[model samples]
Target: MSPASSDAQWYEAKVPPPLLGLAGLFLQHRLAPAGGGSWPRRAAGLGLSGGAVALMGSAAGTFRRRGTTVDPLHPDRAEQLVTDGPFARTRNPMYLGMAAVLAAHAVARGGVLTWLPVAGFVAAIDRIQVPPEERALHRVFGQDYADYTRTVRRWV
Candidate 1:
């Protein structure tokens, strides 16, 4: 489905972070797994599963330092606006969480069916939610945001 019609209204958010978030999700489910069945599919599942585990570490670190919030687009209101932990690497750990969740689900299911959740995650985060958030962060942090931007990669 087009992200425009999705619940997140991602096009409305108009944020680049969310788009990248969803792309990562899609890559995990749609492209990570290859073939229609068994061996090849299982290999993809292992790769995504491993990636998900790593994301989990990053997610935990982010929450520990920044205080995990359900909202992805309003992190400037974050308890600490952490520059350390996972925030040191990505501006949006929540999106990473969402992507990790999708990957885990695909790994658990082990088939083309896994692709659906990944696509949904991308649509939800990228098109539906993140744009307005980045703007809010920029408004709140200003040049600090610029400095943070210069320091970190959007995603790893």
Candidate 2:
């Protein structure tokens, strides 16, 4: 989702590529040695991505069941107002979880080359994906949703 407003207004800074670069290196090399042991590490990445998909899918399902629509591009739909499970801690826990998995992939095998792409991915999501969702929510939920926004963070 796109960021409706500049994150720079609230955040002090963005993450540098180097840190993300390291995640890539791990993704590519599967760091912690690579000659023999591999199954557990590989499973970890799969698990991260898989589990996140499930959780986010569940969130989507909840919205669907409630007769609400969820946009892949925004955080605005919640006809029943789900605030449980992964959602309780992070306002956009699904996205946060998915990002963690992607970052893990970078770490699992991306190395230095993965940094720029990862940063760009996050930026695009912030600028293009999140705003419409927020805007849609502003229309659907109105004041009650706005109040929730005041208490919860957009992302953790």
Candidate 3:
């Protein structure tokens, strides 16, 4: 669907991404066999997952502190154009964090099929959620948003 289209489906515009990531994690565990990996690999996976969580928390906290809306469904309610902290690195740190959590699960699980969920979550968010978010931010912030987009990658 087009980013500015108001006729977007519920899954495209309403479903929270954390739920999708959780479903993806559930599917990965249900579909893939538990993988065997070295302790270091597992530790790295744990660290990645923790870091992802931290990134998301930081992003949310930044929004809250800046008095901006954290609800992705209501981008127009944002009071400020957040560009510091995690936003400085990537435009969608929260979404990236969700994807990273899935990737961490896949890494720890050690199965090729596990990665499928990660890819799926990324694709769904990128295609369905990010477009509208970007459009709204650009509409609200105009040239400032455009400049930020030029400097920050959407998903890094």
Candidate 2 residues lying further than 4 Å off, grouped into runs, are 1-41, 73-78
Candidate topping lDDT = 3
Clashing pairs in 1: 8-128, 10-127, 10-128, 15-131, 18-126, 19-126, 22-122, 73-133
Query: For model 3, what is the error of residue 87's alpha carbon versus the real structure, in angstroms, after optimal superposition?
Result: 0.6
TM-score of 3: 0.88
lDDT of each: 0.60, 0.56, 0.86
* Per-model TM against the reference: 0.56, 0.61, 0.88
Cα displacement (Å) at residue 63, model 2: 1.8
Ranking by lDDT: 3, 1, 2
Q: Which candidate would rank higher by TM-score, 1 or 3?
A: 3
Model 2, TM vs. native: 0.61
Clashes of each: 8, 24, 0
Residue 79, model 2, lDDT: 60
Residue-level lDDT of model 2, residues 44-150, one tens digit each, is 76777777678767766666666654544333434656555555655666566556666556544434554445565557556755665566667667886687778
- Looking at model 3, residue 126 earns an lDDT score of 92
Model 1 weakest 10-residue run by lDDT: 3-12
